[model samples]
Target: MSEKVEDRIKELEERLASTKVNKATQKSINFIKFQLARLREDLIRIASSKKGGGGGFGIKRTGDAQVAFIGFPSVGKSSLLNLLTEGNTHSKVASYDFTTVTAIPGMMNIEEAKVQLIDLPGIILGAAAGKGRGKEVLAAVRSAELVLVILCFRSDGTINLSDLKTIRMELNNAGIRLNTRVPKIVIKERTRGGIHFTYKGHQLMDADEVKSLMNDLKVRNAGVYFSEPDITPDQLIDFIFGNRIYTREFVVINKSDLMKTPISPEKITEAIGHEHWVMISAKNKENINTLRHNIFMELNLIRVFLKPPREEADMDEPIILHRGDTLEKLCRKIHKRFINDYRYSLVWGKSAKHPGQKFDNLDHIIEDGDIISIYLKR
Candidate 1:
């Protein structure tokens, strides 16, 4: 069965490679891509079933946010982990490859938030297909809120773009989408009706093609809404599979001290085509502060202070919440009964219309540095 799926995937790949991207062939190309995505999803399911679904790294998530370190073996992952956590973690560091064979957990304290940093085993070329603990590593990565791709400079002071590409491909194959947003497509199903697709703006594929794809997926009765103009068939597959993990990612160029000449940030940005790259020598503790700040900023965490009625806000220990978290969620986090006895909430920050604004809307979203005081029924 797997062999047949692989053969079909290869055939589709060949066809897609040879096909031209013109208006006449666009629908055919989209259909081929959709078929390929379905086949890949099937392959992943079969592989997971064969593995007995029991080989993933079983690390409980902790801290305000979780971050994972992923790279090739001996790429200074352990060193970076130690530096990030300030030697609070006990990952095995060595000059040889594959020194750390399991996921090492660490806690990084940035201001009031304690971010959990995980150092997983190195990923190889076929890591996504369950090679050399690749599945376990990716499992850890899926649970993380952020990913740090650590790259080591070559002996000639040049960054290896191939290494970065390999790592990214592995992550992509594992269904972990880094720094990507979920497609703005929503599907609603009814018990007895044909598939209906309603879209706005310019769609990538016509409604008939979308209905055909839905029929292929056995979705006989559904209403598909395409809110985004550029929704692709692969993204539709992703939404259907519903297991793909989307998270933020940043690149770290480790061992910068080994370079004969310092690489400028502009050159690095141009090389990666991303502004999220940071260069640091973990062994020498250089630019560690900058990396920490970047991590905090990318996490989109907001510190909200709590205050009792007629009392000053507790600015010393603020509750950490992700950006766009609602007041109801915050109340539930504070205490389950707070929602039941909720009266109103006073806010003092950017989220408020005016300073110390009072509102009772449970759906009110909180902002960074906001001071919130919850009032409940007496």
Candidate 2:
């Protein structure tokens, strides 16, 4: 398997080098591809950290991702989990504050990534300094790779900048330096907009209208782009999406289905400022899948196909793979490890269309929509 994995890496490197006849032209594309390769190393790190019982205030799940969720009280963190997993949990959520006190970690599948969403206590200003749940707040944010800034938008459908500031300050106090770099937003709707979307107050054509917006907004620091008009949606995203986004979108949005007369998807788009946005009903199950799909898409993550041995009748079924992945990462996850753990494996589909391609290591960088089959050692 090592030999085969090395061969694939060599092939990819060669292709990357050969295709780049001009060093300066394909810089961005090459940079992104390089980051994609680097993610394999990250998978190894995530796998290692999980085995250690999740580093520090962070808790690891039985899978491959180390994602975290943070917001103010009654910001509907648990409710968001219920919507994501449809799994039974506590609380329905409301306009009030201070809902969840303890951390309720939930398993969420975003495309090829198996992510752990940590519903920590609602963070207030000075959380790190031990003021207003500060100690607990800092503890939670200290170990997160991804952060979600959930806000209960003001009565007029505008987000309170101060609330945003509080979450940032609290994280800083907690010792996590998350800024426009590692944050996403979820604005719970208090008003109108259909399941469909609209931009800048105009109605989007379909229920998935938010997808384009998610791609466009990307991520940026309010401090950095405070006075740059050239920082339009696409440029803003390109500038901050990966260099600061960990080869993915550092920003995301949730809570669209809550509106009574919901604003147009376009209005949601303009309101987003400079981060990826998606409307979801953290309480109701409506448009949740849409939100999830947007998450997978905006992050630029590819899904790897998981298949059982050839003897199995259903050999085509696939499980997705993303960053923070490892072979031992989910030992309990494989229906049968001995059966799946062959010394060598084959990869195909989007990444390497030729079937029967071989690989040596399970930790190899997997592209989106990759099909894989493992061969056990004798």
Backbone clashes per model, in order?
A: 0, 27
Per-model lDDT: 0.84, 0.50
Candidate 2 lDDT, 295-336, residue by residue in tens: 555444445556656743233444544444444332224656
**Measured by TM-score, how close is model 2 to the native structure?**
0.53
**lDDT per residue, candidate 1, 310-339, as tens digits?**
999898998888999999979987898999
TM-score of decoy 1:
0.87
Top-TM-score candidate index: 1
Worst 10 residues of 2 by lDDT: 219-228
User: After aligning candidate 1 to the native by TM-score, how far in Å is the CA of 103 from where it should be?
Assistant: 1.0
Which regions of candidate 1 fall more than 4 Å away from where they truly are? 1-55, 190-193
